[model samples]
Target: MEKQVKKKKKKRCSKVKKKMISSLLVLFAILLAVPVVSAQTSLNNNVPSSNSDATLTSEEQKKLDERTIILKEYFLNVEMAKAELDKLKEAQSENVGPRASLVEIDKKIEVAALRVEELKEKLPVGLEKIQTAKESGNVSALSSAADYAITEIQIFWDSTQSKYLAHTAGNFTSTNWKKDRETDPYMTGWRDFGGYDGYSVYSLHYNINIYNPNFQTIHHADHTQYTDWTSTASTYPDARGYAWKYQDKGYQNWPIWMTDWADYNNWRQLGWYFFDFVGGKPSGNASFSASFGHTWASTTINSISYPAGFGWSTNSNRWDKGQSKAFTF
Candidate 1:
């Protein structure tokens, strides 16, 4: 009975030892697996495991994109500024009046251009590096550089536009003058005559011939007389006969002193017969006239005519013409 009890106790002790060993093994495995799992979770959460080389995050990529946009905007602004500055320079040169302010504007444009160049130099890399980074999709660095470049460009453009506005305003205030002259001669006749308004004198002349029947010979003489006359009457009476001749007989060889020669008998009794008359009718009557005149008139009364009133002044002592009112009260 004593031996059997001892054997049973030994068996129970062996079984207890086996169970303790199994529990220890399971506990050790759980400890080791905990560290490994924690390490893997930390690495997965922090970085992309698929490509261990990649270091940039989504936030970083977004920032790079924003910077790139800014850079592009600034660069475009710089180009715009340069164009505006060039236009201002052209306008300044073409302007006939004073443009002292335009020099200052040009200086500003040059300074802006220099600033842009400086910004470009300050960027991280040379052209090659930027191109490589761009091709590689490293947008963060590229965008940051672009932001700085664009800022410089925008400043330059704004300054250029301001100066351009000032130049345009000056040109707007400026004035211009031009002169023109008439190149054709005046046409005047009994039918229709055209003449300039401001002309001083308009003269016309016609030749005359006389026949002496009493002397039994032809007495031919030519004389020209000019008058400030216009068209003649459409119908007039013949001077040689008692009956009135209704025809277009232009005035010829009529004395200046004699008036009221509308009567045909009165003109004939005075020995004044129209030349080129066939059977008491006018045949070859021809005349020519010339006119002279002024073309332009001045705006100010002081420059109306010439010499005397050209540079005259009013009671207010103001310069009327040829002087700009800009920058002066």
Candidate 2:
């Protein structure tokens, strides 16, 4: 049964990813390059799956519904962003507005679109476990399987950038991390980079996937990755990032953090993340200031003394950025 669940999870994640990608193509076509003849553009309203399974409790189903609505909003936002981008392009060409203002709007649109896509990817991946349990027509087991479906997905995103005097260019942390993307619910990938603060962080782990499944339980899967420093010091530094998901079947996030940061004894937890199952909303800003690390070496703020860091940091001037999304299906 577990094997079947894993296999189904793999397939479902792939489908969800493919859909995430395909939607943007249309968004670009209708919103950016093209003109809107009708103000009402078609949107991917992620209606509640019509599947009539008794596997989920009313509470469980409610959580799922909220995520569906969230996705619908994102789809709408993309359409709107596209329209705005189009207008900016037109204004730039016709000299209708200040070039700087148009450029600023264009950057905002890109950030928003990237955020929406990251959330979409984290939501539906590894959902077929619940489906497989439902297919068995066993509501009791499905009750257990409900835990297989994460109720609240929280993400701590990574932002990586670099600066030399007044010039700064980067934000490739997203793309660079993408070089070794893994869809599996359980895996880790590492690459060698420079170290910092006299710590031997020769290699950095860009990806961390937690595939926690037990007899039954539900806990948010939270993830945090770091690129503490660069080989050379700078007024500004670059770091990149991506989103992370989590799970719990008698699992604790602290252990993962402990294991993840075993190599860095003196490092500060620039920021930390802690989540509970009470309930959560899907908005990009929940943990937006997270990322690989920084371009500068200012004594990492948000220091919480030793390995007991959980929750976000109080300081917020760092150039770090990342995105996270929660969902149900």
Best by lDDT: 2
- State the lDDT at 120 in candidate 1: 46
Model 1: per-residue lDDT, tens digit, 84-151? 44445545667545566767766866776676566545432211110111222311111111101111
lDDT of 2 by residue, 89-116 (tens): 4445565567788787678667755764
Decoy 1 TM-score against native = 0.19
Q: Which segments of candidate 1 are over 4 A away from where they belong?
A: 1-61, 124-329
Q: Per model, how many backbone clashes are there? A: 3, 20
lDDT of each: 0.24, 0.27
Instruction: In angstroms, give how far residue 284 of model 1 lies from its true place.
Output: 98
Clashing pairs in 1: 68-143, 71-146, 74-150
lDDT of model number 2 = 0.27
